[model samples]
Each structure stands twice: as C-alpha cells, then as structure tokens.
Target chain A: MSPVSTSASRLVYDALKSCGVRLMSALPETWLVHLIGLAEADPDMTLVRLAKEEEGVGISAGAHLAGVKSAMLMQNHGFLASINGIVSCAQLYRIPLLMLVSYRGEFGERDPWQTEGGGVTEDLLRALRIPFARLENPSHVSHRIAKAQTLAHSANKPVALLLCRDLMWEEQT
Target chain B: MRRLDALRAVYSQLEGRIVVTIMGAVAAELQSIGHRPNFFYLQHAMGLASSLGLGIALSRPDRQVVVFDGDGSVLMNLGGLTTLARYRPRNLVHVVFDNESLLSVGGFPTATSTGSDLAGIAAAAGVPRTQTVRSIDEFTHAFDEALAAEDLTTLVAKVEPVGPSAYVTDLSLLENRFQFQRYLKESRTTR
Candidate 1:
C-alpha cells in the first residue's frame, strides 16, 4: 500500500474538519502560512486573526459557545500570554476547544529565541494543567491532531498539540 | 472586611453557582481557601476572566455565575465590560477587587489609582446595577442584593493590595485541565 499523503498543515486542517471545527483563530506564524492559505481558499472554513494569543483563546471560546467548534493556533512563546485566557475562560466555562502550538526551540534547533521555549514547553503545559502531545514527525501529525480533537470535543475542555520545530519548518518537496 | 473573607462567604453561601476567578492574587486567595472544584482560576491572564464567565452564565442560563476580577485585570480588557453589558447575561455577577495596582506581579499602580472608576465604567456601559463596597459586611450584603436583581451587576470591592498567601508552584496545569475536561463530560451526562 502507498504511504499516507500529508504535511503538518494538511494534518491540522483535515483533523479540524473531521472534528467539525468551524472557526479557527490564528496568528500569522510561518508554520501556518500554508494552513492559512488553505483556510483562505476553503469556503466552509472561517479563520479569525487575533492581535494577541490571549485574544485568540477568548475568540475561540466565544465562537465555540455560539454553536461552532473552534481552535486557536499560536506559537510556543504565545502560550505564556494565553495561559490565563485558557485557564480562566476555556477551562472555567468548559469550552471544548483545540489549540495548535508550534514548538519553537527543541534539542538540535538553531533559533536563539526558541531555545527557551523548547526548554520549558512541557513544564508550561504541566503548570497550566493542559494535556498536550508533541508531534515528532510529519507522518504522525494527522493522528496526533485527531487525538487532540478527540480530547477537546469529548472532554469539552481545551486540548493542545505541540508541533515540533523541525516538523513545522522542514520542507518536504 | 478582607477580600478573602468576602470570597469565602460568597463561595460558602452560594450553591450550584459557577464562579470564574480572574488571574492575579484573587485566584490564589480563592485556591488557598480550599479550592472548590467549580472555581476556575485564570492563573496569569488578566481581564478576559469576565468574558469567560459571561460564556458560562449564558451557556447555562439555569445556573448563577460569578466573576472575581481584579481592578488591573479588568482595565486590561475594559472593552469586555461594554460587550458584556450589550449581551447582558442576567445571572452574571461581576465582582472586581480594586486594589489599585498590579498586585500579583508587583505592587505597581494602575489607572484606577489615578481615578479610573471601573464600576462607573461598568454602569456607564449599561450594567443594570453597580456599587462600590469597602467592608466584608458590605460585600456580602451587596452581593446578595445584586444576585437577587434580575440584571447583570458589578461590585467594586475596595481592597488593599494583597501578597500571595500560597506560593504554590507545584500544582499540575495538565492535570487541572484534564480533570476539568472530565468534569465537563460528567456534567453533560447529568444534563
């Protein structure tokens, strides 16, 4: 059998579709340029751009409450800013939402700013009490995205999927 | 009256109430008083606490919802109050602790210290009822009265800046989110 065809962006959008997510709040990150391109092209999808990460969470929560499944996408560093919104609003109001976080700095990564984010990624999630899974490869992206969706909708709580730095930035042409 | 005392009284007296605590010292205080599973603390994000509470109150119209927000946090998203007032969730009770500073990060003064009246802002934004309270007795009485009214209410508690009572850095964020997810699932089955 031929290998499954996918990219990090494809994995995310496909799973979001399967989960019935109607509104997707995102920031303009390099990782999501392609995903945004897809969203911009899709007629059924609604992508809302936020000025800040915290605002994305609030918007997603609002959209979810208004009878639409939603997700918030942001960078790893953005987590610190958005944590309060996640805990206070999403967790408190029991909004079933998914957050897609692009892992910035990981072991063997080159970006100087990302090093700090890669270092504390797990601790941050653990401290915020958000269940998350780190995707290691592009092939497994779809499955992990699906799991994030399942956890979000089934539990009616926020769930995150941390897309590893290499997986998001590496090109596969 | 202390902010803690007022919060404890509110929590104890109110049953089946969904309370959303905003980020800052208020949340830490609420947790220190033997956190009820129903209380959701923002941990670090300020201001948006009321927006979340509005979602809950509107979502579950049958349940009464309360938001314990700090003055600094409220100012961060002051626009939210106007939005909240426009939507008007009748069962929502918003109580702001006006310590006049970013007490949680450090005792830095806020615009409220320089005469920014958030309660007045809330009233001007069309909140049906708004009041300022300085003592515990006042808080309890006002809160009771506010809840009784069939409209969205805002209570500004004139509190002094408080230091963290619990320096707890060990509580699990992942576990909290997971447990809350479980709670929502359970709540659905019950509904």
Candidate 2:
C-alpha cells in the first residue's frame, strides 16, 4: 500500500543492503523521491541528504577510506556537477564509490535543461574511464547493483548504476 | 602572523591525533615540520581534505582527526561545512589558513581578500564553535581549545599570504595512505 513498497524501490534497497552499502548520500530528484524516503526509513543505512552532489562524492571517498562501503544517490544533472570532485578526489585517489544515478531527461522528459545532462550521462562516465551499467527494469536492479559494487571494490575506483526512466515511471492515472 | 609561524605553534600542541593536510603550503609546512605516518597529505584534491577527515573521524570515533586547510580549499567546497555540521563528529578539528589568496595557484586573490568571512560562514553553517584568529598567540590558544573540545570546531586564522619557501616534499602519497591505514588498523587490533 505504501509508495516505496513498489517493485523498483524494493529491488534497489535489497540490493544496496546485500552489497554492504552502509552509508548513502542523496539530493532530490522527482523520480527518486520515493527511493530516497525508503533509504531514510532504513535503520541499517546511514543516509545523508547533501546540498550538492560533489559533497556526497567527497564524503563517500572519506567514508570508503574509513572502512564503510558508501553510495551516492543523485540525479543525472547532479552527476555532471560532481565531475570535478569525482575525478580529482575519487578517481585520482582510487577511492571506491558506488553511484546510483537517476536517469533524467530521457525520451519523455518535460524539461529542456535535462536534455544535455541526460544525453551525455553515459558518455561522461565513459570519458572519465568509469565503468557503468544501465538499470532498465526490475530484474536488472540487483545484478547490476551487485556488479557495480564488485567493480568498485576490486578496481579501487568508482562505478555507476544508472536507473533508467522505464523502471521509475508509472501511470499518471 | 604568518602561516608557517602559526603551523609551528599549532604543530607543537598536536598529540594523539591523525592529521589530514590539503595541497600546497599547508601540506608543505606540515611536511617541513615533521613527517610521520599519522599525517595524511592529500594532493590535487582541493576542498576534500575536511570531507576525508570527516569520513575517518566517523569511522574511527576513538581517534581525533585534524585537517590543515586553506581559504581556497575551503571555499572550493563550503557545502562540506554543512555536511560537517550535519554529521557533527566530535573528534574533528578544521583549521583554515586564511591568507585571502589562492596562495598555491600563482597567488590569485580569492573572495577572502575582498571580504569573505569563513568563520562567520562556518558558524552560520551550524558548526558548534567557530573562531577567527589573527595572531600567533590567538591561533595557538584557539587551536588548543579546539583540540580539547568534544564537538566540531572550525578555526579561521587570518595571516599574510606568504610562503616563499613552499616546495615539493620527498614523501610518497601511496605510502602515506598505506601507513595511515595501517596505523589505524593496528590501533584497532591492539584495542
């Protein structure tokens, strides 16, 4: 009956816990609001709401160093904004961080501003030499999240799991 | 007061604490004073020293972590202040070297030179204790108080932007991180 008990949030939360992500940082994205709420209500996860996504990157780098597996949940626009922090801190230092990004400005996007960010999301991650996977539906969430976590830990670097529009959007009725 | 002078005094008062130094004069000065595994110097990651320290402080609540920062570095990420306030790690000390210039980057004047008050910013950002000091004596006193406190403290020390002798150090970045982690790990084992 609750908003977050839906298929998408359940799979993501279950995957995050099983992957050993103890801390999470997020900024608001309309599609992610429900998932963010789910994380807030979780007792096992220490969730931090960030003013900017870059701070989440920096904080996650530190948290990773301190032996806590950390993840950053942000919108695609926020991911671009966090490029410098991600490159200079996480990539340069070889700090492992799992980024859970909401894919904005997709085919049905209503905002013009989101087009550029969403269009270049995968390209930017690729340019940065960060490995990533697309999370398109309910079945893809757990496998992709686990793979991203494994890649981050083994390579001592960051990886991205982009939550696609299909899995998040629902009938407006 | 000069930054080097302040560092010498501040370095003397430090004990049983892990230090994280941002790039430039702060890291160079800390290195010139003494090199130890307890000191972690971050290079090329401006505005991240405090965030890194916050992570370690939260992870190892038993140990104190001090960050040697600069005006340029802190301004690069003021949002870190809000995060620090939110986390409120008691064993964290943020010491800002406010010389009002990006001293490491060809001395371009920063907002602090025009009129940016970092101490007021920190206090406004909800840091428990924020102090701005201008003299060597004042800095030593403020830093001492910060080290002794059990809550988050931010000290902004105003000084002349002059580090004529700031140069490269002979330390290894990877080695420093390994040693720092090793020290923390060993400490945990013994406890």
Name the top TM-score candidate. Answer: 2
Report the C-alpha lDDT of model 1 over B1-191, residue by residue, as the tens digit. 57777778877755556667766567677777776655666565567777667655555566677888888888888767876787688988999989888776668899999999989999998888999999988998999998888579999999877757554535454454445445544564676
Q: Among these predicted structures, which one has the highest lDDT?
A: 2
Docking class of 2: medium
Summarize candidate 2's per-residue lDDT along B92-153 as a digit string, tens digits: 99999899998777889999988989999999999999999999999998888888887899
Looking at model 1, the pairs that clash are: A84-B45, A126-B173, A127-B173, A128-B173, A129-B173, A129-B174, A130-B173, A130-B174
Flag regions of model 1 displaced more than 4 Å: A1-56, A59-68, A71-173
Task: DockQ for every model, please.
Answer: 0.12, 0.59
Q: How many angstroms is residue A1 displaced in model 1 relative to the true structure, after the best TM-score fit? A: 48
Please give the C-alpha DockQ score of model 1. Answer: 0.12
> lDDT of each structure?
0.73, 0.84
| Candidate 2 segments exceeding 4 Å error | A1-5, B164-166
- What lDDT is reached at residue B110 by model 1? 95
The alpha-carbon deviation from the true structure for residue A14 of candidate 2, after best TM-score superposition, in angstroms, is 1.5
- Please give, as one word, the docking class of candidate 1: incorrect
